[model samples]
Target: MSGNFKMLAKTLYGFEPILAKELRNLGAGNVEEGVRNVTFDGDTGFLYKANLCLRTALKIMKPISRFRVFSEKELYRQVYDIDWSDLFDHDKTFAIDTTMNSEVFNNSLFVSQRAKDAIVDKFRATTRQRPNVNTHDPDIRINIHLYKNSCTVSLDSSGTSLHQRGYRISTNIAPINEVLAAGLLLTSGWNGTTDFLDPMCGSGTFLIEAAMIACNVPANINRSSYSFMHWNDFDDELYEKIIAASLNKTREFHHKIIGYDKAPSATRKAQENVDNANLSEYITIERKDFFRTEKPVDTKLHMVFNPPYGERLQIDVEDFYAKIGNTLKQNYPGTNAWLITSNLEALKYVGLRPSRKIKAFNGKLESRLVKYEMYEGSKKAKYKTDTQ
Candidate 1:
């Protein structure tokens, strides 16, 4: 067994705890949570497993060096001291991303530029040839974090964000990030046990992510690319073994996973993406208006989705939200519905108060993930007072 090394997995707001939990469940050691990242320890194989299985991680970073920097010269020298040539080949491509939270550095782009120059100079001096810099898509992506005088450099193991699961080629008007979708599902206490639905559906992100979680499938099982694959120390056999072991652990899901969208275009796109994930058998996408339809199943239903936050949908936000509450209260019962939206004002018109409200961010918009419960068998659903 290779010895353990420290790593960090970045995530969205309010997701640190879930990411930490995911890391612990994946056998990571000393798991700790940060502002938007979780720190943990694992070996190389564990790293591969993390990249493959973590549903909430945006990217897994392997910190290689940490030092105190005082000046640009020292920064260049320190960055250049690393053995870049040993990490990847001279023919490979690379890109540097810098995050500065200190007064010592003003511009992140400048810092990234300095680091990139150091890497290029290091390669030229050592191997008489330098790797090309490809920002859009690179073989290796490097990250630099600066906090006051402390600087740490790490490698981005997952080239594209884990949200880019590679299965979502067909997108709708508003598609939730895959990692964020999975995290929201977990937060709503969704597993593979009960029926699930995405009323608005969009591109069926929640449906696909929920199905994967239900079956214990690796989040990135459908993705074929990773920056680690280009690393000099990458072991193809070890990765294959990890994939096989992960696939073996997948459990069977028995509950119904359905999606409903009023727009036929959305239903078509959702079905296309579901097929891409090879989950068409488990998820059913229907071109039906949720407000006019009743729950397809008689059992308990768990629903989570991202409603149009008044950005793309040209309708009265307040009236639309009110209709949502009325539909659930009148038509759907024995259901737990969770929705995320940036329009806080529209929530008040819903009439029924949310049982739970959690702060979350849908991209740049500060939003709330609210839950409403519709009781079964004629017991009037109680409304919580809208406390804006």
Candidate 2:
């Protein structure tokens, strides 16, 4: 537990609570949830585990400095006061990414430039050398956040976003983000208790995430690297032990995980991605139009998928959504179908009344994750009749 420090795990909007819960379950101390971020205390090994296990987090950051500033000069002064050379050597490259919602700073890019100047000047003053800035691929990523007069500087422990789980090499068009797909599955109350399905399985993200969640498999089991691995204090032995211990906790999943897509290419990509994740044993992919297929299982089924939103796909939106409703109502029984879509106009065409509708975002488009329950018997699903 040496090198234990505070870390912040950043996530998307509305995912802070789930990320915080995940942190607590993973033995994080002083877990506090912020807007799109969660702060907690853990050691270097825990940092590795957090990156490996957190399904909702986009990145994990380690805060190095926090100070109040009244002016731009003060910002540069405070940033320069930090002993930058002690944190990393001048031989290593670094990059600064800044976020600002304050009156003191007009542009986040300017703030980042000033901060980088301070760090570079400090390094040159001490070692007579300056680390080159490699924005695309840096050895160390520095995050600067300024709100009003308060500012915090942290090291980005996760280099690329944690959504790059390294298992999804092949992706279909409009394949959902890995973190968003996992969060949607979690919010739908999917816990591997019964059979699972992704009717419009684009690259099988939901199916793979569901299988991993059910099997207690580490989220980043296939990921090969993290920003922390390049840090000066990274301990190889400790990291290896952490990986082994996490893998030891993996449990068995008895229920089935299934995926289906009308497009043959999508089905093929999903199969390849599942195989890359080494999860073919737990997932099955089929190339069948969801509307033409029935619920494959008799028992209660948990289903989640992202149907085409009609933004890029050249399909008749109303007809497609109506077919989805008809297929679910008449064929899929004993199933809880959860789908995320941004087509509000098309959603009305579904005809079946959604039991629950939660607001979510599919990338930049605001969407809703609606749930439709199909009972086991011949009870007609309730529908809202037009009064006008």
Candidate 3:
């Protein structure tokens, strides 16, 4: 616990490499990428900094114990062997979340229940007291991962998901997740060099994320709570120092970050969220139809948006996507347009060859983040010769 130890940062699908890059950039040691997670070595202060600054990570966990187990009895014994009371107080309410891919364990809930019992029994035997289990909200979160016959027990240093940046108080029907929005913005190579836009922005998620990335702001600077704060060995002064250091690293962003939503309610909510994030000085929300409007700036524009996926919002998918292509090709030139949509069929209706397409997921729906580079000159003019 005192020296450098390994930790894992969980992320969304296809974001492992970027998350790893973030960890390495933050001075993490021995960084390695997994399927949907990245493993790195860091001390306690670095652990706090990782939670504070990582943009693509959903959760940061520190593994405490690793062993091999075959039977349920062995699992309980392995869990009981650890001194749980030393890690957290007996009064601190805790919950166990188990994820497994093994033939021995048929149910994850049963595993969690057994592990919880083991922890309780161990505490009762040693301290003559046990902590209560709070499923909805817990002071301490324990994660159990079993792969094949090997098991690793981890402490979830992040209380809730990092996506809850504690900035948004209002949201539309289909608001994008903050972490995903940031990851998408990074994927599009947006660095605050030029103007940024999120046309059809819902609740201004992409707008806020873009602004944060542009200024090098820590991802969870607004968040106040974490599961690590409840640990017995927690150092409040160290955490505060980490926060101050992270805040000191933020740089100035001169470019503008803009969002457009035709719905009045969406624009209002977006403005409220921007104010909540304290980034109103850098972002602007407007209620304007994207198709009817031209580019707001003449400089190179970077665009990333999560358009309507036709899940709940009813509209002509073909026509809406076609208009997007037409508007980008005609109205919005000199822009690197990127959009994510689960509707694979509707992508063809856009009628433009994508410069790049990356696989991604919006919740459970399979999606693609496609990029269309609208050159400076007119796309039609480039092709029109003597045919006119």
Candidate 4:
């Protein structure tokens, strides 16, 4: 809790730049991008703000110590030397999550176990009582990262992943991760300048995220808790002030954010999620087949969605994906459409080349985020040539 301290915001594989930009926009100093994380300088207040505002970030970690390690004994000794009681009480529960990229540490589980043992042993030696491990829902979450034999111990300020924005309780067959949805929207340049649409919106994830972006709402405004709240130095008043200041930054959104789905159940659940997010005013959900309908608005439109990749859902992958392209080419004019899908082979049948193709991951599946530019008369020219 110094005036300014170094912090890291972890994100997805290709989201370092977006997260870095977010940190800088949030007034972070010395913002530098790493593999899947961004290092920056921010005070405790900024830490709370980052956790509240950053949409692309997965976790915000505060480094406590970093040291060189060779074997298990050294790891245990180093971990045991830390003053654990200064952070939290013995009555609280904690958990360690280890990520090892070193040849010395063959197993991440063993490293986590060794670190846990050292922490519990240190507590026992000091207070004759030790905190129990709560792997599922820990009061305090510790992060251990070992790369090329150098180990860094950090406290996970975000107890759960930031993607858990606490707004989505009802989900359809396959819902996109909230963080991924936000990152993709940001990458597609959805800054709320124009109208937004998620044509195949399932449960309205993209629609809600779009509404929040349009309104400049804090990403975690609906969330009520974080790991930092469990720390011994937790400041309730400071957090309240932070939340108040963040709420002050929200602005009114004039444009509409719309969602459409063929299934009635999907539309119903999407409206429920929209209500959960408190964004019903800015968003609208409808039950309609995208391929059978024309553009809802006459002005320029921005679209982002994650269609079924045929991984968990049963469908004709080629036909489904081709219909997406066909519908857009025929009906959606003057629109910038972006879609993410892991079905690479099926993507070939879309009958249009993507203007931009970015590699991304939907959970463990490797996916591509592609953009299609639909001009006012591009489809007419294609049909005219065929008729000739």
TM-scores for every predicted model:
0.96, 0.95, 0.97, 0.96
Candidate 3 collision pairs: none
The TM-score measured for candidate 3 stands at 0.97
Give the local distance difference test score of model 4.
0.93
Better of 1 and 3 by TM-score: 3
Model 4 TM-score relative to the real fold: 0.96
The best candidate in terms of TM-score: 3
Question: How do the residues 151-216 of candidate 4 rate in per-residue lDDT, one tens digit apiece?
Answer: 999999999999999999899887999999999999999999888889999999999998888888
The number of the candidate with the highest lDDT is 3
Candidate 3's displacement at residue 114, Å, is: 0.9
Tell me the tens digit of each residue's lDDT in model 1 across 259-348: 999988899999999999999989999989888988889999999988887887778888788889999898888899999988988889
RMSD of 1: 3.3
**Which 10 consecutive positions of candidate 1 have the poorest summed lDDT?**
379-388
Q: TM-score rank, highest first?
A: 3, 1, 4, 2
Candidate that beats the other on lDDT, 2 or 4, i.e. the better one: 4
- In the predicted model 1, the residue pairs found to clash are none
Give candidate 4 regions above 4 Å deviation: 379-388
Give the whole-model CA lDDT for all candidates, comma-separated.
Answer: 0.92, 0.90, 0.94, 0.93
